[model samples]
Target: MTTTTSSLLNIRPNFFYDKVINWFPGHMAKGLRIISEKMSSIDVIVEARDARIPISSINKKFEEVANVKERIIVYNKCDLAEESSQDIITKAFEKYRNQKVLFTNANMDRNIKTIINIAANKARENPQKYPFVTVMVVGMPNVGKSSIINSMRRLGVHRGKAARTGANPGITRAVSNTTIKVLENPTVYLIDTPGVMIPHIPDPVCSLKVALTGGIMDHLSDEEVIADYLLWRLNNFSNFGYVEKFKLPGPTDDVNVLLPAVSKRIGALHKQGCLRLSGT
Candidate 1:
């Protein structure tokens, strides 16, 4: 738990901090190439980004490939974030990408209506003679690309779970072979593409946020490191929910001390000398 604002800004450690994290897999590169090649067919690119770390979650590969197309930024997980923060995110992302931004909650049915409305509105801008409207949902992994599709289906036509949902990132390894119909009033179809990540996460802050938000695979990150980062964030905001949730002795910055307590409380290690969750 940091006490001041300067500590929040300076996430880079004095030593022992790696500037970059390698989260890109071979599948991601393939996915990026596929999205780049297929960009011509998409009428609208609905880029889903996490609300908590708006600035950090943008996948640059999507920008390089889909910049020419009409983009709608979907700030997913609005329920997890504060209202004021969501407003700030909507504005910052709108200005940064020069695209329309809509805050959405994919798990619940709320705010799902605006997605197709925006897509239909974008489709109308072109005035094509096509019979159906095609929308491609894309973003970093586990950012609700699939969940968004299912939510639209549930909202628009009373369908259920059109796409898979999970806790881990990179669940959707590639683009779907066929489009899922989410709306019928204007007849909109959505293409749920695999969430793509930049090849190298150069900014430590961005990588931390991505990992914290489940955009990157946990195996690639040290769990203790991620835990410490989360602790710092909760402390920065004066959030002591962990104290009650984990039964801690107040709050602590050292994940070294925190994890053993947590591990013991959760019955993770029965005969531990010093707890090592990495299994090294």
Candidate 2:
């Protein structure tokens, strides 16, 4: 909670804020190593990503692992992101002819079924010439991998009855193996890996918003300007209407007019006489 001001930028800085910016811990390095070691045994890789930020959620390093096996991209939380954004994302991935892309709300039963069907198709089309097919579920924390597995089990697609599911994020922390019989064609095996936040080229502004809105930022940043930038983006982006409903102040064409407008809306008043528009 200690706040420090940066003389260079005239911005307040805090150690807690630094922690938020650096939330992706070093443990991911070990996770990547483990995934690399297990790639040989995996037949098809199922990657789950937030539909809101599909491109950002994906780890570029996945290309390295995917080169060894078939990759199926699952766009989870499709219900959250804007429809137009989702369409753009689907088209963007269409160039990867080798990969199969699927959009679904992993929390729902039908979408989970669709995912299973697509995965089965990907496994059957595998050119590796392997006798048995294996699919590994991967994604960032809270992307709904476990929930999807549980839904598959409910539909009787997954054979083992002991698999557990939960509502919270980071529920599945270890690799677990399970087997299922796919309607008399062949026996399918699945490997579930621990969800790790994929590291990417950081955009401090966008990352801050994603982390804060999704509860991913455990430590709050001390830089209010960063938050201001986020508010500005949210206000400008018509898709993020919820932000305006929160009555947050946002920048406009003219700082003078915009400041007073936002200050009144956010209830920031000056102690002496006028409204304190500086912070807004």
Judging by lDDT against the true structure, name the best candidate.
1
lDDT tens readout by residue for model 1, 1-280: 3244343344434324565666878888888788877887888888988887777888777778778987888888988988799767656756876668888888886688988887666556554654567888889888888888999888877888888889998778888879898877677898887888878787886787888888888888776777887877776676767766677766666677677778777877657555645554
How well is each residue in 1-280 modelled by candidate 2, as lDDT tens digits? 2112221122223212222354454555666667788888887788878787776676677777777676778887788778788677667767656557787775566466665565566447763564566777777766777666666555545444334555444555566644544323444566777667656546665456456445253334433444454444443443334325444232232234444545566778575536763444
Cα deviation at 41, candidate 1, in Å, is 1.6
lDDT (0 to 1) per candidate: 0.78, 0.59
Instruction: For model 1, give the 10-residue run with minimal summed lDDT.
Output: 7-16
Best by TM-score: 1
**Model 2: per-residue Cα lDDT at residue 177:** 46
Span of 10 residues, lowest total lDDT, candidate 2: 1-10
After aligning candidate 2 to the native by TM-score, how far in Å is the CA of 270 from where it should be?
Answer: 22
Q: For candidate 1, what is the lDDT?
A: 0.78
